[model samples]
Target: MVKRKSPLRKFLFYFGLVIIASIILIPFYYMLIVSFHADYDPYKTSFNNLTLRNYAEIFGLIQSTEEAFFGDEITKRNLESINTKLERLKSISASKESYLTYVEETLIPEKEKELRNMIELIMDFSGLTPENREEYLQNAMKIGTKEYNEIMENAQIILSEGDITLLNDLYYFLNNYKSEEFLDKELAKVKEQINELEEQKQKIIAEKATEFPFLKYMKNSLMFAGLGALFSLIFAMLGGYAISRLRFRGKGMLQRSVLVVYLFGGTVIMVPLYQMAVKLGILSTPFGAGVYLIIVYIIQTLPVSLYMLGNYFRTIPYSIEEAAIIDGCTRMQTILKIIIPLSAPAIVTVYIYAFMIGWNEYLFASAFLGLKSYKDLFTLPIGLNAFSQSAHSVWGRLMAASLVSAVPIIIIFSLMEKYLTAGFTAGGVKE
Candidate 1:
């Protein structure tokens, strides 16, 4: 029979739990608060500019705030193009009615001077008599059927004769006959493009490939962590079963070796693992980095998994396996059908532990993954480091990204919490 605890002892136990819980939870609460801030420092928690824009930016939901959007380099380029068109329009507007009448007296003389020079050149080319020359001049000014045909034929002849300069002047004058219509349409197209860009400021525009590869980083992290957990669980399950139940020579030594490997610090093994990865030609690639990280995680967690599962398996009586054997079950089948069912709590605990190890590992990932060139292959932690180290270091964005990255680990723990607690507290098959 167990003895009951006194009220003071129970009170201290609950009070201690509360203190430990606060110690673990306060940082997370701070992170959450900072995630919603536009610009915040822990020393100044005034809650003035709190927003979800950081999350919006991270998920590519919005390009940026309206002010930042307009201030972007692309916006500046578009503005320069628009300004060029505006300047051209200003020049073209000098010929409009508002300004034309004030300068018409001087402009008409200049125009007549050029037209007279053109008429003399046409006469020299056509070589017409006096009456024909007068008719040609009148027709050229008014653009009659005869004059139009004559000008067209003459222009073609000049073009074919390689008189490009004179032909260009003639074509320019003719093309600008409806100058307002032509310039208006050209100006309209440019303004339309500018307007579209302005509209884009209100929506998300993630076209800048150099900015952030959010989705790629998220996917790589999930893949690396998920696979690491799965493979680690598989190997740990087999190894734990063998250590706990199977008979073999040097088994104690093998168990000791596992413990030693788990106890080995990452700093001690980093250089050797890196050299191995280099030799294997897996450096800088997603597969190479992921596999290397997964292997390290498996080695790291396998010892704990083996120890916990071994102890759990010990509590399951050998009589159960013998009973299964008498019922014609193979050794593998007995382990699978009997041992696994009894060890679910421990398995879940180890799996969650392995996943967290893989997900949160930063030192080796940064050292081995070659993050500079292969940034898209970055895990969340590496990406976060890169983000924080960038020139525009927005703490709010960093906090938001950190919060989002931690959500998966939190969810995994939440789902497996009961199993983990059961693994710690419950023993098996006591008579």
Candidate 2:
């Protein structure tokens, strides 16, 4: 027989859904509206106007200096080239004797000797023997006065090229290249400009930093939600299987125990848990804190997870497991290959629930992670609190951060809600 759902029930369900949705969306809407507001004074209740200046400032697009765009390499290369030119000028100006010696060694050797010999022959032209004169005349043109004159001319040419007047001037006045008064005036102006720009950038960065905390908090919320869902699914599947298939003693007691744990509040054991964490040195570092928090979350989430999965497992027929065994399958195989596939919706529901519990948890996070030095180790809740306390709290940026953090979770839930509901209801209905 098919049974139709009552219209009153449908109306109530939709009404409840609407209320829940509003509860979730109102804060986000408020944040989005505020993020567009330009007035930054936290004490002032009213906003002056909406502007993109705050966002631009945070991103370093507006009022940014040219220096910010340039890398260190360009500056370094310029400095190096300047230094190299300075060193070359200094070397040239340091020793005139060394410069002359270089010229003598390089340019005067072959030409000077030949030219001196030719000058001797010209002066002794009448007294020279025929053979001697012939020998002198033959070699004279090749290695004598004419050759020496040519070499001297070449040396003059080389010396003209090697003239150090420009280099000497540069070396002598390198220190005074820029006048002190001029440099000081230019430097002051540049510093003043930099200071103004830096101040503006700082203001924008401060606003954006405030927003980052809330965004981080939102991520923490999602992480916890996902973890909770996973734990819940495991518990639901295992617990359901045990109750449905096993003929164990104290089954009723076990069921009641699971319920008792679920009913147990986290506040009751907060002190002891804190002490245990301290003793174990879990409070010493961020990683330790995360470990402690995960443990606490697992303990808190286990019971409900077990109950949800156990209930789901109970709804499946025992005949299916028996049929699998008859088909030469092991119990593990039957459960993995048969039962789990059928209980997908229930598993998904448990996973989602567990994830939510972990994601939303704040009390334990705040209490246990009270130290300020380990603030980075803190979850989203702690980060949000820190953001709220900072000066120049721009509500718009905060809202932006909040929205960025939340949109993912909302999307995931919206897509999976149908499957999760189906799993939950399937576990509830048993033949």
Candidate 3:
């Protein structure tokens, strides 16, 4: 009979796995839930209130409703002010003669005239004309059932065409005053002010609703991390090949000291690194920050890269390299043609490792590039930190952005993971 491990041990092993997996997955599940629901309440939102708008907003697909609301608020307030004054004036007047005189002199000609200019901009677009439109000053009571009906009909047409400015003006003109022939021009003026309000709102949204900090930070991170990973891969491969293949002075000491950077945690060396960067002036400009970050990333990746690749390089048989030399291949040509192609899997692994260090690193990046003036050079980690601390309470957006940032790591892993499993196993592993 084949010997078997105890069932109790297997049970405990699976149990531990389940517990650890839950610990990791619970927060991720919550973040995903929150991303889908902007107004997330733990107790509620079981079936309703789910939306993809959070993703849409982060990716620049749609504008946030809160932004749209604030953009329109200026015009809304002005509309309310005009309405309030008109109501107050109506109540204070002693009689119809006085009310007509005050409105004609103060409200219509003065308050309404400024708005009238704006309406003329899109008069042709308004869909109102002589037959249906009420004339403003001829008789205040000639806005009959037929004219009122015609305005409503045309307002719907304006609305369907997405001319909200014109629709609003029509509604304002209809509700505010009893009308006549002059009412047509008066309605036109209301359109102008509403249009101005709409323009102001559009302008505000245009300024704020863009793919900034996200796209910018992504670019900086990619450039810094990309260059770091590439250089680390190249230098690590060379160093690893030298150590594994060449007999040189202090080789043992060099191999041992290569990993010494890892002994001091980032917190331990952070102050020293910051001081050094300050002296070097690498924190002075965005270009400097980028250079420093790339150097830092290389440091973070190189030690592990050297160790991983060095050990893996040793597993390849020495006779293959001897054959390359017999074929008159130079040392560098041997590495390029024989060793590098054979070590493809390990190189990819080291690259992925280096990339991850640069991508997810926060402590050094923040310490070195965290000056307020250098915000344009912020990496994804720095941008996310600032985003989370923003005064705007956009939890859903934050959650969405956090997940979106992880996509690159996921993609990199997926595209390169196939190379990871067969490095030393098939590459002539030996002591």
Q: For this target, which candidate reaches the highest lDDT against the unseen true structure?
A: 3
Candidate 2 residue lDDT tens string, 21-120: 9999797667767767744444567776776644554444544332331222433344455456545444433454443443346434544444445334
List TM-scores for all candidates, in order: 0.61, 0.55, 0.63
Candidate 2 vs candidate 3: the TM-score winner is 3
Cα error, residue 191 of model 3, in Å, equals 17
Residue range 1-431, candidate 1, lDDT tens digits: 99899999999999999999999999988888877865523245466666887687778776544245423455445545655655554554544453344234444456556765665676577664456667666666544466756765675665455554654454454435346775465455545665665555333333432355566778887877778778878887787788888899988997776557645777788889888887888774766776777777677666666766777788889999999999999989988999999888777787776777777878777876744356767887787788677644566667788888888777876887787666546431100
CA lDDT of every candidate: 0.67, 0.59, 0.68
Looking at model 3, residue 201 earns an lDDT score of: 54
Where model 3 places Cα greater than 4 Å from the true spot, the runs are 1-17, 39-47, 64-207, 411-431
Worst 10 residues of 3 by lDDT: 133-142
**Would you give me the overall lDDT of model 2?**
0.59
Worst 10 residues of 2 by lDDT: 63-72
Ranking by TM-score: 3, 1, 2
lDDT of 3 by residue, 313-340 (tens): 9999999999989999999999999999
Candidate 1 RMSD computed on C-alpha atoms after optimal superposition onto the true structure: 11.3
> Top model by TM-score, which number?
3
lDDT of 3 at 323: 94
Indicate whether candidate 1 or candidate 3 has the larger lDDT.
3
Clash count per candidate: 0, 19, 12
Question: Candidate 3 at residue 360, lDDT?
Answer: 82
TM-score of 1: 0.61
